[model samples]
Target: MKRIQIEKIFHHNAYRIGVFFDKDFEVIAILKRIGATYSGSRRCWYLDYSKASYHKLRFHFPDLVVVTESSNTTLVTGINNRDLSPIASSSVLQLDSTLSNPEHKQTQITSEKLKLQLLPSIGKYWVFKMHFHHEISKQLLKIKGVYWNGNYKSYMVFRNETVKQHVEAVLGVGSFFGSDYFTKDLLPVKGKIKILPHTEATSWMEVYVPKLVAVHEKLKRFSLARFSKSKNCYLLPAAPIVMDSLHLQFESTGIDIENLLPKNYLDKRNLPNKKQLDLSKTKKSLLDMVPVQAQTYLSSMIDTLLALNYSSSTLRTYCGAFIQFLRYFEFRNPESINREEIIRFLGSLMERGLSATSGHSMVNGVQFYYQQVLGKVDYSFVLPRPKKEKKLPVVLTMEECLQIFKVVDNPKHKLLLLIGYGAGLRVSEIVSLKWSDILFEEQKIHIKNAKGKKDRMVMLPYSIVTSLQLYRELYKGKHYVFEGQFAGEPYSTGSVQQVMRNALKLTGLEKKATVHTLRHSFATHLLENGTDIRYIQQFLGHSSIKTTTIYTHLTKTAVDKIQSPLDRMVDLKSKKKLEE
Candidate 1:
């Protein structure tokens, strides 16, 4: 499950908040109830900048991390006007003293005068509007609290008396007290650049140039500018110096440079390797290379799936198979394509090493598109389906399973393996297990939302109960019985697989088995110990008895009970010799 993140941005004289969530309906309903309005332009929700709005957000989402650009010193206090009387009065007094200074008279009457105007903004900040004069602007930019706001076309400074007085003294009162300031005319020649996260490993930046100002040839060449069709913007590799130059250029354009990029962008750790970067590029290329008509058909297929209430996983699988089918035919018109073409395509897939199960899935996707979407009843693409493989699942001997447990020293790893085998839980089911799912009193594991969205109860072995308690004490999981680094997040399936692999290697087991093999061993062992087939089916969450019967082939109970005809013949021969 994706965690919720609330990012508060000070944009266009208001606090624009963007929420990243996993589409939980209750959370969205809460946001709507709080009077937060969504903005299509910015792709986020917003409320007028105020203390009450911020508090309301905090109230609704108490645990969500709020990402902000402002420094700790400049954090908004969310205090009422009645509470801000002292600070307001002190600021007015400081302005009075700066205006009465007699020592600054000469410098005030210079040829090119600087003008500063302060306007009250949201929270404890003031918008300082001014025009650019080459010499004086440099001096103003050097101040710690002063920074430009691009969207507002003004500078922002902490509402502090000392900072305001210092600005007046530097600009000279004559230069600071003019009403002819125009921020639009003073817009920086070089435009804004924004760096954002593309993935965990990669970073991408967008270059938004001013209409009048042309991009510098040297900067463009150094950055190796490439246009991304998906983003509809030019992108550059997020090198450290390149990012610094982009920020410096935008800051020169008069935008405040506070936390311009994400916190992780500057860190020189776990950067994307060449292969990862190439894979991203390849995915983009494939998306862009898709023909327009094929994209239309793909969208129609997705819409149909949604209308029919198909599961998300099924929709994703079908769409992927359809995309491959379209690409194979160079995205030919779907209406013009015939059954023979689809038959040829399925044959081609087999020739290229596609498994029978995958080929069946592809056929289903195409059949759905034509029969359901196009309303074609006679779309007969009857190709010989490949025979399903009847290979028995690899089961670990009891001794080998014990050996694996002995080698896995980490308590978490041991518990994960033991639970998988002990409770006959699938890999996905095991990772998704929450603390509430474990009924300690009943000694049953409540396996909710298993395969086919069915829920069942499984026996929790008494032998591992103490071990489970110890692991829980060591990890202190917040939600999931096994949690990842982040609180409330489930432990990853990949991590569990790695633990299994390491155990197998340490035990020197040559069997081609995975984490699911533990589940297989559990069912087979239960069958060997005289467990009913119906109970085994329920334990494994199998929809059909035939599915559960596969374990019967691996069990030795029935075979061990039968005496061979050869053994009976040997007994008769021995008896006849004794009689003689």
Candidate 2:
């Protein structure tokens, strides 16, 4: 006869009856189907404790030998084939006497009446449903890895040679019918949860497909999910509720949900299983990357930037530039490298022929380190900065922009370029966008916490709205408007630049342009169309009208209208030559 042990245990913030077994698949499956949840820590399946929960166990498996236990010893048959001790002997437990005693002699339900129902395994378990007396139920419960499905009123049991052998050895083959369903994966699995490296100490489930889009639309609907391109998965907030939600959303898609049990723990380490973050994506600290002598200064600088609530991009740029300065004074004291030495360092950087922009960034990075981080060090000496280059912003003609878009075949890539040229967004602003920022009803994108810690609204052209909706449906990007390879993270700034480069190459445009060129083109094209400079300033998120007016120099239509002196005086020489 099949044997199981039951005892009251507090779990899941409730009193539950812990169902113990000898790893019997059938008994486990029955318990699971009837709403029992498994606890790996307890190494048993559990059901909510109640009168119904207790009697329900016997309702299914009548012949099960239930041994109840106390806080003390739960000894069964000893080596001597007799009770070794009076105080720690095995106990045959009886339920509420009003219930356990049938009150009348019961007719035995025999195995001949139990017709085994079988089908191919849907996933790890064979799915089957049956209606039978408790005696017949005991026969099925003898099989290993069995679980009851309360929803379908079925017992989906494991089918394997190991389980079959266990049954034949424990109970004769004649005791229970062999109803086997081949174990195999059935559903089309489009994704699986992976953990990102950033969350190793406190684990998280990062669900990802092999490629661009996630398998289902609902995965993107998770409010707490964030996309990590470095890990190429949607990083989920570590919570049991999130795991439960994932199971509900992906159970039908079939990607080894049962195997992920270890990841769903409530501990800081969480997921479907306690999957740690990917090792490859773990970033080295700037402090670690710098010379050992300079690490102290770099650590202080990073802490100050974080306390100020600076954007991650700003923190990275400023810290990186400051690290270069620190490296120069690796042997010198950090406090001593402030005034005259800083200017000399700037001169050395200029002498290397770096860009005017790099010079400006380096100045700011160094200034922040001294003023904000060091607190009392007012290094106000005149710094030798590189002369600002006066080159105008590169602007693509409307025809050129259109030609590039036409040559690009990927819908995702095409939409990316169109947003760049049409929306007048900086490359940084574009990549930080989330789908929640889209205001389709207003036909504007709510640019949240943009550069300089300001919010602004930018137009969403009606022409690209359809494309945006279609892209959302096809990609089902969670959170971000232009999600990277997977949902959650905005498309990478590097990927956006690469898309621009690919388009320019395909269109054979030799013009030197970066992703920001699209923004310049957007502003210049608007100016050419006679949009007021103030409105253009708002569209470009420029704090000053002077910044917007730079587009005036780039507008071809305005420049074309003003006839040049050379063009006006051109006809006289040509006319004389024609007459001669």
Per-candidate clash tally: 2, 24
lDDT of 1 by residue, 141-244 (tens): 78877776543456765455666666666666633333333234554443344445555336555544433333433235332466666765556655565565
lDDT of 2: 0.64
Task: Report the Cα lDDT for residue 453, model 1.
Answer: 74
Best by TM-score: 2
Error of 2 at 155 (Å): 38
What global local distance difference test value does model 1 have? 0.64
Q: What TM-score does structure 1 among the candidates reach? A: 0.50
Q: Quantify all predictions' global Cα lDDT against the true fold.
A: 0.64, 0.64
User: In model 2, what lDDT does residue 440 have?
Assistant: 91
Q: Mark the 10 consecutive residues where model 1 has the least summed lDDT.
A: 78-87
Cα TM-score per model: 0.50, 0.53
Q: Model 2 residue 493 lDDT?
A: 81
With candidate 2 superimposed using the best TM-score fit, by how many Å does residue 573's alpha carbon deviate from the native?
A: 3.6
State the lDDT of candidate 2 residue by residue for 233-261, as single tens digits: 66776666566656645555555443243
